[model samples]
Target: MRANLCSLTFLLALTLQITYTTSKHLAERPSFLNPCDYNGANFDKCFADNFQLLFSHWHDGVPGLKSLGSLDPLSIKRIKIQQDSGATLNIVAELENMLAYNASKAIVKKATLDKSNFEVDATLELPALYAEGNYKVKGTVLGLNINGAGKCNLEAARIRLNFHLATKLRDEGDLTFSDIVSLKAKILEIGDFHIDVQNLFGGQRDLEATANDLFNQNWRELFGILSPTLEQTLELVLKDRFTKIYAYVPATYFISNMPRASEFYG
Candidate 1:
């Protein structure tokens, strides 16, 4: 059970890593992604709309962003998650052809960029994402011990995310520049979650059916215990992802039309 739990954690981390990893050099922003003008009267609204558009094309590789064209139906080597030394739950699983969906439907509540101090804040609400994959999972889930294999699907619903990005000032010879320094992300709310893993107890058809029922019936309680750790993992994963992206893509591409740092400081 411990082994399986570790494997699930590893696989989940791998899945998230692959989803956001990007590296390429584009001298300018892609035309499809229209940049927002900070000087505009409706800068916040413009920025929010632009942010939503980015997610709409998230899974698909935008030529201007990265060339890693496809990011769906990923083959997971292994996955494991253990809670409290397996006292609560332990799951070690493997998934083939995994795909995560519904990011395009995300809604941006508000987004603001404060150039004076080089800070960015955004609030977003995601209704749900259905993740489906062919899986083999073993351990305790919903207070039942079971061995399961076959198709599995899960849904995480009513999640809200808040993000803040900070920048640092850099002095290079005669020119001063603002560089992305850090990112903080938080999960504000999670209303519900559903997990379905088929074929539990290995070859026992009746037990399998009953286990699935229990999973559906007791998801809320299970999720409540799991949400805290999940949120921390998500925040760390997202911070790493955006930081890497900013590393590869120059700041000029993001705010080229805005007033120059020279003009503001001079």
Candidate 2:
């Protein structure tokens, strides 16, 4: 009887151990914020929450342009978004351009109505975006024609923007764009027109070097002359993006228990 009791106790302990190990593994697996297990009912909510979390980081990273004194950086005038098979977002905001300290102070890059332009419409192929469990945003400024009072007709200017975010442990996706693109502009009549090739290169290098500098500086306020209409194409693979799919679809197995006869002798 003593031996039999001991054997039963050992079997019970083994069973408990197996259960604990399996449960722990399941818990550790990576899961989607809103799993697509139940159709796409929760897709929208999941997308919004994930996007905000991702964009917040980007918004915070970009230091406020101080060329416009005491102006709010987060004040975006117009925003438009459209999601078909993919998603497209268009945003319009005032941007300030700063000048070097040695430059003229009278030429403060003050904010002007002519300096405030809109992002031109552009189409982005969303399907090309394949970073599941990730968010990717790309933008480009085209046809930047500077037409205003002082130093107008700064023709043939261009700007480009690219953004990417991933929640997965590893960054896996094809998120690269072609190096070469085009820009076109028409020179308009305005203030003195002077082309300073050296100043242009110097200004760009300075901005890159002092990317975080913002306190006391004079900069030119340039409006977003135009932006291409936004077009986006995106592709998502839910299972591959989240590792939790492996746990939910575990391998099939059969469990069987055979009866054993035991006798207690006096």
lDDT scores in order: 0.62, 0.19
Off by over 4 Å in 1: 1-24, 32-34, 64-79, 85-97, 134-137, 167-181, 248-250, 256-266
- Worst ten in a row by lDDT for model 2: 7-16
How close is each model in CA RMSD to the real structure? 5.6, 28.2
The CA-based lDDT of model 1 is what? 0.62
Q: For residues 1-266, what per-residue lDDT tens digits would candidate 1 score against the true structure?
A: 22223322433443433344333444456665666565767767876776666466554644554423323332233344445435556555566556667756778899887878778798989898788877776677656777767888888899898888896544443333446687777778877777777766766878877887787777665565555556655555456545545554445444436655566666
TM-score of every model versus the real structure: 0.71, 0.17
TM-score of 1: 0.71
Give the Cα error of residue 247 in candidate 1, in Å.
3.6
**Candidate 1, poorest ten consecutive residues by summed lDDT:** 1-10
In model 2, which runs have C-alpha deviations exceeding 4 angstroms? Answer: 1-40, 62-266
Best by lDDT: 1
lDDT value, candidate 2, whole model: 0.19
RMSD of model 2, in Å?
A: 28.2
Residues 57-160, candidate 2, lDDT per residue (tens digit)? Answer: 32222122111111111221222222111112122222123111110111111111110121111211111111011112122112121111111012112222
For residue 26, what is the lDDT in candidate 2? Answer: 25
